[model samples]
Every structure is written in C-alpha cells, then in structure tokens.
Target: MKTKLLIIHSSDELYGSDRILLQVVQALRDTYRITVWLPVDHQDGKHQLYRMLQERAVEVQHMDMPILRRALLTPKGLVRMARLAPQVARKLRSSGADQVYLMTSACLLLAPLARLAGRKKTTLHIQEPWGPREAMLLRQLAKFTQQRIAISQTVARSTGFAADQLSVVHNAVPRLDPANPPKPLELDADCARGPRYLVASRWVRHKGHGTLLKAWSMAGCPGTLYVLGSAPDSANRIDVRGMVAEFVSDTASVKIIGQVANPQDWFDSVDALVLPTDTVEGCGLVALEAFRHGKAAIVSDSGGPAEVVDNGVDGWIFTAGDVPELARIFDRCTASSLAAMGEAGLRKYEEKYTPERFDENMRAEMPGALLGS
Candidate 1:
C-alpha cells in the first residue's frame, strides 16, 4: 500500500510556501498517496494552489486549522477552536495518513493534531522567520516532530531549532522554456528615458513596493518601475493600491500589472527584477526567477535575499528600506552592467536552480521524510 501524506498548509494562496508545497506534491504524487489540507474555506479552481493541485489530479481538502487565527483569540472564537481541533484531528485519523506535512509556523497546531490522529511522523516546513509567539509555539512543536525544514539558513537561525533537528533546503525553480529564451529587452523607447525593472509578488507590506517607490523618488525616477503582483487571499491589512499612490511622487512612473495569468512573458520585457523588501523576507524566490530568465535582480539586503544574490556577481543587494542605497544602485547600474549581471544570474540558475536539481536534492536529503516506516 502507498504511504499516505496529509499535507497541511496555512493558506491556499500560491505564495512562496504554497509554491514549494505545489512542487513537492507534483514531484511526489506518483510515489505516495498525497492529500493536501489547506486552512481556508472552500475555494474554486481560481485559487492558484488548489487549481494546480487539481490540474495534477491531487486530492485537495479544506479545513480551517485555527492556530493563531485572530478570531480564535476572542471568547467565542476560543470556544470554536476548542471544538474544532478535535473534529479535525478525528477526521485526520480516519483519513489513514501515514505521515503529516505542515507548512509554515501558522500550522504548528498540526504537530499536536497529527499526534492525536496517531500520525507520529510529522514534518513542518518553515519558509519565513518566526515572530516571538510563533517561535515559542514552534519550540512546543519540537517535542512532537523533529522533522523540520527551513527554506534558508537565515530562517533556520531565526527558529532557534537544533542544528540536527532542522534541515536547510534552499527553494528551487523549474527550468525556463528553452524555446522562449529571454531576448534583449527594450522597455524604454529612449535609452535616456531610464532603466526599466519589475517587482512581482503579493503586494504585502513586507514585500517592499513602498520602499521601491520611495527609492525611485529619491533617485529622481532613474527608470520606470513595473509593479506586478496581486493582493493575496490571506492578506487583510494592506491596502496596496493606496500605499502605491501614497509613496509614488508625481515624476515617477510605476505601472501596476496587478496579477497576470502568465508573468513569464513579462520577463523578456524588463531590464531587471526589483525586490526591495523588509526584514520579514523569505528566500527571494523572485530573484531565482530573474536568474532563470537571464535578468539581473536588485534585492533587499536582509534575510534570504543576501543568500540568493551574490553581491555584484549575479545581482546587487542594497540595504533594505534604505532609499538612498537603492537609489545609488539604480543610478550606478549601467545597461552593460545589468546585461552582464543578467548573464551571470543565468549561469547561476543553470548550475543550481533547475527542476532536476530540486528533485535530486529532495530525494537525497529527505529520503524517508514521508516513506519512513
């Protein structure tokens, strides 16, 4: 009989962690009986993770895992969560899962829930730095399951997890289409107009569009900044559009390509990728995307971005939220330099971030992550 995997994700949005989960499912579906449980209400195929899993014929279920849920903090909400965890645990027991996979610290409750369901072998994937409360909760989770994955070493350090208990797996991207190799970009009609760059991700406060806009103003609009991303499903606080207008000065040109069905096409049109984010950063997956498509990336200095960009080899890393530093990078980078950096980024991509490498790494490093008896 195939070993069953009960994968629990904090949300169904196809953000960084969700994307990694999708890759894992895609890679392991044939090898195991895989089932995904996302902490969300019912979503149609419009949700990227759900749609991708469906397309791959993976069984996807929705169960609102209530750990750290805002509503759960209230009296009535506490009662609801109190009543909910047991029901979810019972359902998990009936599902006959041999192993449980929890993504993000948000799903830390699943570590205990899985044990209640008689699934002793559970793993948690930590993609971002945990806050103080989450860190405390994760410490609690450690007794339940030592099989933890930190997407970058930076994140692993943030967790205070034992070196032996935590494993670092740098996130990987699929190989770009050879037929659609990136060509020379001419985003601006006139060279004097300025360099054109792109920023693609959910416009969350930490993702740093506001910083980019401010830096653009400080640099006197050195180039056009094409903002590409959408409001994520789980995002309730940030008003990105309002923030964009608030940060952008009249002279700056920032285009909002909110969300597109295919952003691969946009890669060929921009000179570089701009990722000026806050300290709450993950392994700069967008930078890997830039590397894949032979585009230079100007990412923030903090967290996983510093690990991704090789300081001036593949791309540049500026002090995050420092408008002057970002402006200086923008002003100093010439067309020839960006082209050179783009080529360097592509070389790094071929060497490290291919789909084959991703599969190989997972197999080598996590042989019994699910299959262990």
Candidate 2:
C-alpha cells in the first residue's frame, strides 16, 4: 500500500512556486497516496493551479489554514495565529497522512504543528530566499522538520540548514513540442521591426519591472518588449502600468500583455526572455521555460538565474539592478545573436533540465523512508 502524504501549500496561483508544487506532485504521485491542501482559492477566480491538479487526478482540499505572510507578523496577527493553531492541529490529526509536506517557506509555521499532530516525518521545501531576520526565525522553525529540500544552492544557503539535513534539487519544467507549438499572439508592434523580447513575472517590486522599464527606455526601446503578468493581491504589488507610462514614451514599442494562462505560448513568439530581478530568486523557472521552448534568456546576476545562464553562452547576464549595463546589453543584442544563444540554451536544457532528470534527483535526494522504501 502507498504511504499517504498530505501536502500543505500557502497560495493557489499558477506562478513559479505554485508550478513547482505541481511538478512535485507529478513526480511523487505514483509512489505515494498524495493529497494537497490549499489555504484559499485564487482571488481572480481562475483556479489555474487547482484545475491542473484535478486534471492530474490528484486529490485537493481547500481550508482556512495558518499561512505566514507579512501581514501575519504583527501583534494582532500573532494572536490570530495563536487562535488558528489548535484548528490547524485538529486538521492535521484527522488527515490520516503518514507524512506531511510543506510546499513553500510560507508554510514553515506548520512544521511544529505537524509534529504536535503526531506526524513525525515532515518535509519542508524551501522555494524562496528569505531575508536575514526571517531566515533566523525560519531556521528555528526548521528544526521541527525531519527533511529539507531547497530548489537551488542559493536557497539552501539562505535556509541555514546543516548539510546533512538538506538537499538541493534544481527545478525543471516539462518540454514543449517544438513542431506543434501554440500559435503566437499577434501584438500591436511590427514583428519585422527589430528583435522581440519578453518579461513574464508577477508584478512585484523585487521582480524588477521598474528597472526593466527604465533600461528599456534608456536603450531607446531597441526592441518590442512584451510585458506579461499582473500584480498579486498583496501589499508588495507594484504599479507596473504606471511605471511603463512614466518611462516609455513610444507606447506602441512596449506591449502590455497582462496575466497569461500559458506563458509558453508567448515564449513561442519572442526571441529571448529578460529577467531583471532586483532580488535573489530561488530558481528562475521562467528561464528554464524559455530554454525548453528553444529561446535565449537575458537575466540579471541575481542568485538563481545567474547560475542557470552561462554568461556568454546560453544567455546573457547583466549586473543585477544596473540599468546602464542592462541597457548596453539590450542595445548590442541582435535577432541573429539571440537565436544562436537560444540554440545553445536548448542543448543545455536537453542535457540537464528535463522532467525525467528532476524526478531522478528527487528520488535520489529525498529520504528512503519518505519514498516508502
């Protein structure tokens, strides 16, 4: 009989961390009786991640659980957390799961609760790189878990976990069909004008939307820059459209393609992907998606993307948050050059970042007891 596993995740959006959660379920579904528990539904009513899990035949549940967020760090929030702990403990006790998996760092608060609920074997997957203060607190909370999984080495270092307790598993996405790819969307800009670039991330301040806009304007808008994604319902949201209006004069040169269901469809339209993140990313999964689609990436020297892109080979890496350097790199790139780099990226993706490779790594790195061995 398969060992029952209960996975608890904070968000329901189909973004980087959310997609990685789906990938984790796919990798372990056959070996474990897995059920996912989400704190809430997507605010936009799309339920993209929820739908995807259902389509995969994975059991999913929605409940009001304690999720760690910026708002939940205040005095009143502490009281609320204190109140919710018993309810969460009850849910965990009744789950009938042999093991509990916390999908992201936001769910780290549940680690101790899971232990109190009599689930001794708990795994915490760290997908976000936390700041020093938060990391200190998380390090304390992490002691309750038996195993830790980090998406990248950068994230592992941030967790302050001992080497023996943690494993680094770089994230990967399923490769798309090159021959029968989704139809590229028709934008307002002319396709034959110059090279086409894309920036697809949540409209958050640290993702560097403002810096990308500033650099695009500084580079005289060399290419058609298509911006995808919208701000989440959070305090950290950025006014992406306002920034574009402030920096970009020739509006037609920058197209705003709002939230997308399948970013790979847009990946089929652009020559390269640009990720100008102001902060460290756990893993730049979008860059992997670009590589899977046989496209190059122009990323900042942030934590994860820098490790993924070879400086002058598969993609270009500029100094993080350096507008002038990014602008210079943008001005120098040509359609032909990006295409060559993209071909190299495809080769790297085939060699390292495939679903099969990720599954193998998961099996090798995860504890044998968790795998029911």
Q: Write the per-residue lDDT of candidate 1 for residues 1-373, one digit (tens) a residue.
A: 7888788887776667788897777666666799988777433355878778888889997776666565467998778777888888888799888888887777787678888888878877888887777678667865577478788888998888777777887889877678865455445553455777888877677777778888887777777777787775665436666866787774447777787767887876777998888766768898999998888999998788789899888889988888888888888877778889999999998888877777776666555544223
Q: Give me the runs in candidate 1 sitting further than 4 Å from their true place.
A: 42-45, 178-192, 231-252, 368-373
Colliding pairs, model 2:
none
For model 2 the TM-score comes to 0.93
Structural similarity to truth (TM-score) of each candidate: 0.89, 0.93
Compute the lDDT of residue 345 as modeled in candidate 1.
94
Worst 10 residues of 1 by lDDT: 364-373
| Clashes per candidate (backbone, < 3 Å) | 0, 0
lDDT per residue for candidate 2 within 87-175, as digits (tens), equals 99999999999999999988888999998999988998999987898988898888888888888888988887766668888999886
